[model samples]
Structures are given as structure tokens and as C-alpha cells.
Target: MLKKRNFPAVDLIALEREACRRSLATFAQRAWHVLEPATPLRWGWALSAMCDHLQAVSRGEITRLLMNVPPGTMKSLLTGVIFPAWEWGPAGKPEKRFLSTAHMQTLAIRDNLKCRRLIQLEWFQSRWPVQLQDDNNAKLRFENTATGFREAMAFTSMTGARGDRVLLDDPLSAADGNSDAALLAAELAFLETLPTRINNDHSAIIVVMQRLHERDTSGLILSKGLPYTHLCLPMRFEPDRRCETNIGFRDPRIKDGELLFPERFPEAQVAELERTLGSYATAGQLQQRPVPRGGGLFKREWFGTIPALPVGCRFVRGWDLAATEDAEAAATAGVLMAQAPDGRFIVADVARAQLGPMGVERLMRATAEQDRAAHGAVRGSFPQDPGQAGKAQAQHLLRHVLTGFDYHFSPESGDKETRALPLAAQAEAGNVFLLEGPWNAQFLDEIALFPMGKWKDQVDAASRAFTELTTKRQASSSSGTLRGFF
Candidate 1:
């Protein structure tokens, strides 16, 4: 026998109002009815996540935040429409100024109108003390009597205005992804312009968009290693890619390949999206990865992995050298590959890092020593650049750094794509295999993207190593002895 406990009508009303004021999610639910009376509320965890992170920003906990979500997840409605209004009314921050932008002016203005419409509703006005200015009628700009204003503009048109919060929603359209110049300009804008538009060090910048390319704004920020709290939620759950943020936020899904928001977008709908969007679009827009699944030119299924090295295999390590530890710069990569007895290629190990000239030499020498200790008679293949400086550098490594090692230096001929063709053919034919190690993911990702990927140091080293290994295999067949060079 259980009895139901009930509060007074007045008390219940007060409690509901207090809850709406305290939490952004509650406020968004209350505001959604006023904005979309015909549409039902299909609430999910993804919506709650955006609200939580946005509230954290409103509380001055996070200054820079980047969110990568799918296309139809109501990202704009939460960030562009509801966030500023809730902060002004419920959160008691009526004086907060906001600047919001999208790829086009029309898109920004559309969200601006929605926010203004929600704020002017009778129910909203009765509860919150927000008063709009009489002259605040422009689609691009609006103001409240409490000194809070929201301005809308294109991402390229961001200048001559500052705000307490900057919201960038879908800053680049996928239609323009084919133009490399356009992509570069968008990245440059984020790096050079957007930072200048913030009011102060305390101001917050929030970017919400689906990844469109490897060189998009999100990619640039991540590659440059800038300080931003990233919250990436793909359409499906990938256990290996479950993102954990600095704010103690992690994807709660435990199952692999589970739907992110099945309430709104069911499994069937997601399948249709994948089929229609194709692999490239689906990967960028839905999966939050710029590369296609199973890879681009180098298919993931084409290569296999082995647990241990095969017996009677000849080993060689290739070096693609670079100086300076810049995040945007190319890294020095070394690939240790083996030619098995049955004429198959095994990628035993890969080591890559951005370093100075001295650091590069140290790593080369260290890698040589390690390879020799593990696999006997592992030879080194170093690339020789054109001209006298290149010859001097190669001679220096052979004489000073690698004094006792068997090595050879040869000038690299042809472009990177052409040189990688032979390896790509072997990989396509299922002849290329990888030795099981911790380096598989990065190595495969780089190889998958191939010539189109941003960094090619690892692929270049692997290609050179494969060439060196095969060349020796052919030479030994004719000469009947393994030749050595120091």
C-alpha cells in the first residue's frame, strides 16, 4: 500500500519556474514549444550534452569550445537560438552580448529571427525580465534594454564587432569543399580573424559544425594543437573514438555502433542517410571523420596483420627527415619493413616525430640500434636531396652518426604519388601486411588517405623502405650474395 505525495499548486508552479531558470536544458524544453508549436519534442542525450556544455560556458568555466555533431541534430536551434535567450532571461545574464555567424548571411539571419520570435512571446515575457529595444528590428542585429545584443553575420564578414560570446554554426558549407582555395581561406579566417573578434580573455568562443574536409576549421584547430575543449558526437558510436573532454564529459554509449539519437533518427533513417550521402559525405558529416571508412585509395581490407615476424626475412629501415617540431610542419618518419621468404611485405614498425636536425640524427641512430638489436642485419636507407648540401648531409650521417651501420644513400626521383604507386599496387593485391603493434591505426590512417592526406612523411618512408627491400631481394637473386654498404 503506497500513498502519493503532492505539493500545493502554487508550490509546484514555483518549482517548475526555478528549474527552468537553473538548467539550460529545462529552459530549452520550455522555449521549444513557443518556437515550434507543430513539431513534437524528440529529446535525446545529444541535446542534453550540448546544453550542459553551453551552460558550462555560460558559467565562465570554458572559454573555447568546439563541437562536431551530425547535420540534423538541432545544433543550430540549441546554440544559435535558445542559448542567448536563456542566458539573457533564465540565467540572469541579460547584459551578455553575443555575435553569431554561419557560412551565409541568410542562414545567420534566419536563426536571428527565430531567437527574436522566441523572446517576444507572451509566455517568455511574463516569466523573464527581458525587454527588447524599440529600434531593434533588423534581421542582422537586435538589442534588449538590458544592454544585451545579438548580431548576425557571415563568417568571412567577422570584423568591427566584439562580443562576450561568439557562436559559429556551420561556418563552412559542404558545397564549397571542392575548392581548395576556399578551404584554405576558411582555415585562415579562423586562425587570423576570429580570435581578434573576442571582447577579452574572459570572452568565450563556441564553434559547432559537421566536419566537411580535412582542412576545415575544426581540422586546423586540432592539427595546430590549439587550446579548445572538443566535444565530438558522431551519428553512431565507435568505441575506439569515444571522446573524453577536459570538462569531464565522455560519450555515455557503451555499445559499439549504437545510434546517437534513435528517438529522432532511427536506425533505418541513418542507413538511408549513409546510402544517399555516399562514403565520403557520410564519413565527414555523420562520422565526424574527413576520410572515408575503410579508407580512400588504400582500402583497409586490402592489408592484413601478422602477430610475429616470419623466419628468413630481410629487414630494412627507411628515413624521411624533417626539422622543427611544428604541429603544422611535416614530421621525420622511419619505417622498418621486412621482405618475407614468400615474397610478401611486412611492415614491422613505424616511428614518426617532428624534431630539429640534431634530434632527427639522434632518432635515426637510436632507431638503427634498436632495429639491429631486435632483427639482425637490418640495413638503413636514407634519402639524398639534390645538390651539394644534400650530399654533405648524407655523407655526415654515414660518417659521423651511423659509423658502424650498413646503409646506402640515393636521390629520390619522381613525385610522392608516383613513388607510392608500386606500394599501392602491392597493397591492392593483398601482398602487403602489417606487423601487429600499437602503430597500426596511425599508419593505416595515413596510408588510407595517401596522396590526398595532409602529412605524407610516414607513407613516404614506408614507400622508400618497400622499394629498398624489393631492390635487395632482386639483387640477391642475381648476384647470389647480400651486398653491404657503410
Candidate 2:
């Protein structure tokens, strides 16, 4: 049935995974929704996955998990209602422990109420072999005719409670998430608090929340490199729920209201997504993208086009000199970006080090070698300082080294600000790449603060190199025309 749905390759994989959860004696129920009427309108492989993993937990095959869905995808509904009932049902331990967590106490309590409500339903009571305690006990307890109890808890209420599978739901509030500091601190609290409190025997965890921002708990959880599943279903509008290389959406265990996400909101909500969050949020929240910072110019994105160079791609050493001790000199090397017609601006080299001229030169040679090995020997580009003395000094150094590389020395006329403005525009227009790395990042930030031509020596060198290579080729093309002048 799943194969007939015409889902994307990734969605199909999610559906298959969700379906596989049934073999462990527990069922996620989303894939089986068509078989049950009250199953609700949740069928999409990712949504179904929440059901699937919870089912696996019931069977003890899985442990910790993370679900980073977009907002309004009925994440709470599945966690609170459907799975808990399934837990106490065929696959349930009854005596086993469970905990539902959220950023606030009210949310946990609300989920607790849902669990209680579902268990008390007439249909629910018929199938449940175990008898749940009366409401008088409070704190949302369900018993399997034994002393077993599952409870609700807040992030703040961790002092006295312990559980086998602790669920740290969206432990970050929507408001506080705007502040990276608060979110980072809360994320820290999760790892530190749980180990101190949880029991040694029974183990696991689940994180359920929307992907709100980069600095949120989602980021924190990913950084730890723990083994977990991410389930997401963006409900705001037409959502790209299919998993890409770096992002994820809902797990494919359930279907959610016949593609109602797109039908419910669609274009209008997308506009809001654009207005409120820009492309970063749109790519992450709606499109499920790997966070595009500022298009193709930011250096990080351009590294993908690296290639092997030919025998003579023209070795050119573009020197953006910087003195490690002098603050102003240090800021000079803003970009060590390299590019080709087909290749993106890969991180060809970085000239950042607290070094003397020789040290800087060494760094330059090492980077040039790397580029040569990775790419190939290419002609070098050097900025001709407007002053004749500086230009002569550079020429003499190149001539003395016996370096096989050609030094295209050209005089550049412009303030740093004016020179970089074009690069910035070109960057914004997708004409450059930082090839995103630590050194490249520092280089750009410093360049952004450069005072016109004052801090532009490095930029001058780099631009001159690229321009020299390109223009020389152009001039070479018109050599016949010059001869015609005779």
C-alpha cells in the first residue's frame, strides 16, 4: 500500500522503516490507520514513524530518539494520546516507566491530561486489560493491575523523579528560543540533569519539538552526536517533508489528514514564513533546508566545486600580506578564496597567522601547494601597490625566489570600501564562494569592517590576481588586433 502512494524515495524509506516497527510485537499504528477508524487522520510516513518508534520502545528494541518537526504537525497529539494507549495495550509493559517532558509545566500537565482522557474513553476501556487508577490519584497515573505508573514532568521538576524512558519534549519555549543564550543553557540542562537523576537499568529518551532556530535544543542535541531518529511534519503550509541530505521531516509511520498541510495553509502561510524568517527560516522550517546563510557568496557554499587541475592551470601566488603583530595588518587577509569558471570559490589558502613576513610567505606557499595538489599549478596574482617602491619590492622578491609562477603585477586604484563593495555585491549575486571554514570566516568579518583602501591590501592582492589571469587571457585573444595596428 505504501509503494502505491507515489512517495519520494526518502518518504518511501521512512514508510518502510515505520512498517518494520510492527514486527517487534509493537505497532506504530500510523501505517495501520486505514485499518482503524478512530486512528485519526495522521498518515504520512514521518508522522507514522512517531507511532513506530514508540512501538519499538514498548518492545525495548530502541532507546533515545529526537523528533525535530516543524510546528503544528500534531506532535503533541501522537505523544500524548495515540502512543500512550498503545503502550498500555498489546505492547505495553504496564509496570514499565514513562515520562513526557516539555519546556513548561503546563504542557506536560496538558499531555498528561490527554493520556488520562484517552485511557478513560469507552473504546479505550474495552481493550485495556489492565485497570487504570481512578482520577483521584492525580498526576495522570495508569496501572497495569500492578504498581506501575507513568507520569508527567516539567524540565524544572527534575529533582525527585526518575524514569526508564525520559522524554524531553520541546524543552525550549517558543519565546525564549529567540535568545540563543537561554536555549543553549536549557540544552545543557537536559544532558546534565538526566544522567544525575535517571536509573541505571532501564534507559532511553525522546526529544520532540519544531525546528525553531539554529541555536535551539535541536542544535544542542545534534552536536552531542547521539544516536536518535528525527521526525518532522511542517503543518504551517505546503511543507517539503521529504528528507534531504541534511534535513528531516515527519517520520513515515502515519498519514496526517490527506496532505492537509498543503491544503490547510499553503501560499499565505509561506508568505509569512518569508516575511518573518527570511530564507534561513524558510529553508529550515518550511523547505527543510540546511540553513542558507546569505546565498552563494558566503564562502562556505562554494567549496563543493573543488577539482583536479591540469599540468598548467597557471600557478599564480596572490599575496594578501598581513603582519601578525599589527592589528591593522592582521585584518588585511579577509579572504583566501579561490574560484574557477566551473569550480566554486574553494578555500585555496589562508594567510592568517601571528607570523613575520617569512612566516606569512611560508603559509602562502603551503596553501599554494595544497591548491596545486588539489587543483594544479596556476599563475599567481599579486597586487601592485600604487606606490612604485612597494611594487618594485614585490617584483624583486618574486624575481629572487626563482619561482616558476608568473607574477601578474597590476596597479589597483580604489579605497578598501569601494573595492570590496563590488565583491560584496558579487557575493550577494552568487558570484563568489568563501568555501566556509574558520579562517575564511575570520577573514570576511574583518574585511567587512575594513576602512576603504586602508585595510584592503589583501583584497587588492586577491582581486589583482584573479583580474590579471582573466584580463591577460583576454589581451592574449586580441594580440592579432594589436599586430593589425601596424
Candidate 3:
């Protein structure tokens, strides 16, 4: 038997690399390794799913894909830079042309250059022998020997360009996204201009961005109910909610508050981000909701503070119960209000917490105790949402949670916004006084955003409290007059 000459270690390594370069996922890992060898790869399920989606797009299985991920999550590197190169190499679509755009020209060019640098690496060129064509070897625009080309342009300057693949990387910048007009322009360009630039019917369009506004490009595209595969990767993994991808990779996080990529952005870093961005800004940029800043409804300065509750003031505690105990679930909110002698409402305290059904019952009982201690003869109001389920929930709470408390359960009359108008007007007119407490800032923040804020439990609870108090007072006044006449 001819003894097989033992292959050298270098030869075996080269053979393994060549095998890996055949698949898009393996090729992307190799590319990242070769280009960024010093940096450790903090690979996560989101990144893996993103790579699989890109491969699907390359194989013509998916025509359009929308990837919404938080900033600094390597979205740009994977989609805008490496995916195109992988297509030209492992996917064997060397003639594929790419048109990439960003909100700013400089960002687009920077990614284009990084792709160029990645292609120029000795290991890359050695594994996949793609050489840049000298004739069109500019930074913003470049071509390869196989007639493939990539052009980077600003979103505003995407006119008169054609490509087989269109990659939009953060087409709305943080500053530009804040402006309604800019967001509209971006949406229009995406809907009207960009689609016309596709080279053929089979061309692919990939959008990778953080949601900036409810009317941003991602929002506009999704609102149309188009058949586009979406991959949403919020920084914090929401256990109760799983993102479904086209490749059948559902989010695997089974616990609430789990970091998407713990190795890179740990819980501490995410908490710091929340503190820095506040609830409104963080909702959109980090949480992928993009609530407008200083949401146009309620202003902070409109609220005034009171030192103490007046004697013999009528009190009501309104409760809004959420359905689940998941951390991402809406909070169970209780707004405690006291109607003063002047007939203006004073928000004495606000309590908001996430709880399950059993937990909610316990919370309601505890709050009822606190209300009885603070203000004797307190009344309670709980919303009956709609349908049999709502009726059943209201009955359950009445029988179990508020058995001995003086409480009323009524079906919600109108939408949250319509009911909240009275309370909002009171605050705006300086008729509402918030008692000084630690919950004051949180209450103001939630009310200031109103329906736009991520959590509207407090606002809903306050509305119920105010409405129930005024209605009961009117009934009491009318009943007393009839008794006097008798």
C-alpha cells in the first residue's frame, strides 16, 4: 500500500479553509476572521439568522428583507459590507451588482471602502480569486473582473443608478430621523425611486436599519402589508415575544430581560443605555419603537406639585391590569387620586408594576389596603375591556380582589385617547396637582408622552380615576336634592 504522504499542517488548514469558503455562512465567518482577526467574534443567534436570511436572498428564495436591529450591533458590517462580497465569492454570483445607500454620503463610502479592503486581503484574494477591475476601481464605485460592480451613494442621490442588489444601511440618521420631513423623504425614495433602480424583476432589496419613527421607511413598507421577510433583533431579548424569520429561526430566548448578545453588550451596558436614552428615546432606538421626543401631547412644565392632601378629600384608586407577568408585558398600573375642595384633582401617588394574574390580585388588595389607610372611605374603579373575557376578568377582580372595598366595574366607554383627553386638559390647564414624591418624574414622563409612550397604563388609570370621581360626585349631589324635596 502506497503510504499516503502525510499532509503538512499548512496544507490541511488550507484545505479546511477552501471547504468553508464554499458555503455563504462559513465564507462570512472566514471573511470576518481574515479581515478582523484581532477582534473576537461575539456571534449570537441574531447574527446567525441574519446570515441565513442573506443566503436566502442570494438564492432568490427571498426578494425583499427588512432587518431592524439596534445600533452598534454589527448590522452594517454583516449586511452592507460582507454580504455582497460573500455573494461574489461563495454564492458564485460574481456578476451581481450592488447599489448601497446611506442617510449620509460619508457613511456609504466608508462601508464601500471596508468592503474593498476586505476583498483586497491576501487571504481573501488567495481563497477567492476576484480581482478588482482597474477601469472602475474608485472608492465609492468599484467593479470586479466578473463584471460585478458596487456603487455607494447617499439616499438623496440614488437617482439614475441600477443594480442587481440594493442594500440600504441606516438610510435615516439619528439627527435626520427626528425630522418628519426627512423621514417622509426617505420613505418616498425607498417606495418610489429605489424600486425603479433594480436591474431586473429578480433583483433583491435588503433594508437594515433601526426604527427611527412610526412613519420611517421600515414602518411605511410594513404598513403596506407587502411580502417581505422581516428580522427584528431588539438589543434585549423579549421572552414572551419571539421574532420569526424567513429561514424558520425563531428567537430562542426563554427568559425575560436576557441580553441578545451577552458577550458584547451585557445587562449592565444595556441598563446604562436605558438610563442615558430615557424611556422615550430608548423606546425607539434601543427597543425598536422610535417614539418621538417630547411627544406632542403633554408638557412637563404644565404639572404643578402640592405639599399635602386636604382633609375630607374624596379619593379613588383606578386599576389597569395587564394580562401576563412577562417583563415585556404592559404594566399593571394604579393611579391614586384625591378630589380637593376646589374640585380639582390631585394625583397623590402612582404605582406601576408588571405582574401575572395572581400577582395582580395581590397588588390590587395591597393597594386597597394602602388607600384605606391613607384616605378613609376610598372608592375604586376598574376597567372592563370588552367581550366575555373582559366581563369575566371584572367579575373575578370584584369577587376576589376587591371583595370588601367600595369599587365600581364598568366597561370602558371609549378609546384610551378619548377618555384621557379630560385628564390631559386638566394637566395642561394647571387644574391637576401632582403630590411631590419619587413617582412624580415617572408619572410626568408617561403622561407627557400619553398614547405615544411605550407604557400608557398610568395615563389610563388616571383617566378612569378622574372620570369615576366626577360621575359619582354628580350622582351624590342629585340624590341629596331628591331626598330634600321628599
Candidate 4:
């Protein structure tokens, strides 16, 4: 009962040729398939754009390409592993030489092994028969029969290497990036030594790394205003900001806070990363903007200290919550401040701890009870962040934990810099006082660092307290409704 089943004839030769003509992205996908077949490759838009940019550089269409992507986004795999293999095999450019370096020799060698393993795959060798030359096969360097070679070196050993194409992957580690001397040495190596390693004027240079510091390789290269095709892919999309590749592929995410690769890392996971990295570090590594440490608007010496809390001063506790028990997550901060009759502000106490959601609620309740016992009637100020989720969180805290407490939920407006400016100005004028407390050192350090510090909960909570205290006291004084709290 079969109605003569007919299938199209398979064109094995034609299909093989077509496979050779596959784009770099497809080549990477297939290579991943061959290398790790069980684990399917998740091709996000960012990776596709990155592959296209790399392909342009390989084709001599672009001389310099600077790519910035968050860690664990397959940046090293795509750029250092798959691209080189694709260039030699399907692209038919086995004669091209590559010099790859990393901040550490182990990282460079790791990629070297991946590339060699990829080329040695039966699928890859059957498609493009580029045999490795005898006696030249090693972990750090290798050569093929076509005279093309790949040399993996540490960043410190780039003085004597030469190549037609140079790839620098994460030239500085997190610790090195934070050090002035280390960053200076890296900058010098990139500017003075790295360029000399190019074999010819037509040689291409590629740098792939997340932003680490203001003077890091990416920052230095960008500051020079050189002709570089920059491809920046942040973990989350920032509204009104877009990165365009030279081949005309633009970042596809149009919404703010949209994830770069939700299939691999969901929104919750990225948020956890942000919390663990803190705002300042995340701004650089994840958001591609390294804020300067000393360039913050607030200054350390501006903070003045008082001997003790003034009697009859109105008190309020401002809270900034993280709601995670993880030690790496941002800590929840509760700053207690008092407004004097003479319009001066004094920080009475600061309590900060990392806790889960339930733990945070308990801490808030206990802090409220303690403050009430000490200062009769203390008001609590909580920031109602933007969006419906923020509003719902505020409502939940009010209903579940803050019942019977005098509190005000103010909708936060403007950026952190803007909101902290008023307090910064007051502190700079020597009007704000820090009452002697155990939390003095930590609080001052965070406040002085302001927008640049890793943990900013203290700064946020203090700013909220200052704003609330000043505004409420001003309103009461103007309306002639000023009342005293025992």
C-alpha cells in the first residue's frame, strides 16, 4: 500500500563543499557539535554578532577589533578556539599565523589544547585535511603542514613573538587590573611591545576582555581614538545604548534590563551575579564601564564626627535590603540618623548584615524594636524602587514585617549619583556629623567611596535617611506642626 516513496538523492560531494562554505558562526556550532555533541550549543544573538566581527577581521576587512563580553559567555571558546580552527580549515587559510596571549600561561595553553583537539577531530580532519607538522606539535605552540602556526604565550613573554594575527584574551586578571603597577605594566606591554610582534603592516590585532579598570587595555586603546571596530556585549541590555558590529548587525534587545543570553543564564542568575560582584565591579566587568575609585563625588575627609547623639533629636532608620544569605551577596544596611533642632544631621548607628528574605524581615523587626526602645518613637524610611516588582516588595515588607511601625515608603527618583549629591554637598560643607560608634570605619569607607565602592548599601541607606530627615523636618518647621519625641 505504499504509493511509491521517493526521496531526493543525497549530494554528498556538494554537501561537503557547502559545509566548507559555512560561516564562522556555523563553523563554531559544528565544531562544538563535534567536540561536545551531547551538549548542544546555545546560539544567542551576541555570539552571532561576535562571530561576524571576528570573521571580518579574518578576511582583512578590519584591522583591529576590540570585543568586550562578560565572563562565562563563551568569549574564549568562540574567539580563541573556534575562530582559529575555522580560519585554518573551512576558510582555507592554513598559511595564516596566529599569536595568542593571556594574562596567564595556563589560560593560553587551555585554548591551545582546545584548538588542537578541535583540528584533530575526525569530522574536522575529514572535511579539511590539514595535518600537523611533525616535531612541532606542543601545548604552547603548533604548526601545520602549510607553514602556518599558532603560538600561545603569557602576556609577559610577548617581546620575541611574531604573527600575522595577534589575539590578547584577558591581558590582566581581576587582581592585576586593580593594581596600579600591574595595570601600568600591561598598558606598556600593549602599547610598546605587542604591536612589534605583528609580522607585517597588514597584520590584524584583536583584544577580547571585560572592562576591568579605567586604565586597562580596553580603556587605554579606546582613549587613543584609534580606528578599532568595537563590539561590546553586556550581560544585561541598557536602554538607549546599542553596540553595532561593522558587518551591520546591531544589538537586538530593545528593552531595558533584557538579558543577553537568557537561554544560558536566566534573569535571576544574572541578578545573583550582579549582587555578588557588587555595583562598582559589575559596572565595569558586566556593564563595560570601569568607574574610577577616587573619582567619586564624595570625599572621605568631608565626614565630621560628634562625641555623642544630641538629646531630643528626631531619629529615623533608613534601610537598603539585599535579602540573600549568601556571603558574596550585597549586605542589607540599616542606618540610624538624627536631625537636630539647629538643622544639623548626625548618624547615630549603622547595622549591616547578609541575610535571606526571612532573616532580613527578622532583622528589620528587631532593629525597629531596639530603635523604639532607645529613641521612644523612631520613623523608618524605605526606598520604593521603580517598577511594579519594586512596589510589590515594598508592600510586602509593609504588610508582613513593618506592621504597627511608623514608616514612610518614598519612591526613589534619579540615579545614585544624583540622589547622593545633596548629602555629598552637605558633608563637604562640614554640616553632617558621625556619632562615635563601632560602625564608624566601615560606614565612612563606604561613604567616601560612594559610587565606586564594591558595597554601596551603607551609602544608599544613609542617603535615604538624610533625605527623609531633612525633608520631614523642613515640612514640619514650615507648617508650624513641629512635635517633640521623648
Clashes of 1: 0
Candidate 3 overall lDDT versus native: 0.80
Where's the lowest-lDDT run of ten residues in candidate 4? 477-486
Q: Which candidate do you rate higher for lDDT, 2 or 3? A: 3
lDDT for predicted candidate 2 compared with the true structure: 0.53
Candidate 1's TM-score: 0.68
- Residue-wise lDDT of candidate 2 within 65-86, one digit each (tens)? 6776666655676665556656
In the predicted model 4, the residue pairs found to clash are none
lDDT of 1 by residue, 153-212 (tens): 899778878999999998789885555677777887788889998889999999999988
Task: Give per-residue lDDT, candidate 1, residue 247.
Answer: 74
Q: Candidates 1 and 4: which is better by TM-score?
A: 1
Off by over 4 Å in 4: 1-17, 292-486
lDDT of each: 0.87, 0.53, 0.80, 0.82
lDDT of 4 by residue, 1-486 (tens): 869765554465446546655688877776787777798787787888888888898878988999999888889999889888888998889998999999998999999999999999888887788899889999989999999999899986686669988999999998875576788789888988898999998899999999887678998888788788999888878865588766787898988878999878888988999899876678778888775233356766777888977777999898888888887458999999898888888989998999988888899889998999989889887776677787677777777777778765767677666788888888889888899988998887777655644567988898888887777443332222222221
Per-candidate Cα RMSD to the true structure, in Å, reads: 8.0, 14.6, 14.8, 16.8
Could you estimate the TM-score for every candidate?
Answer: 0.68, 0.52, 0.62, 0.62
User: Is 2 or 3 the stronger prediction by TM-score?
Assistant: 3
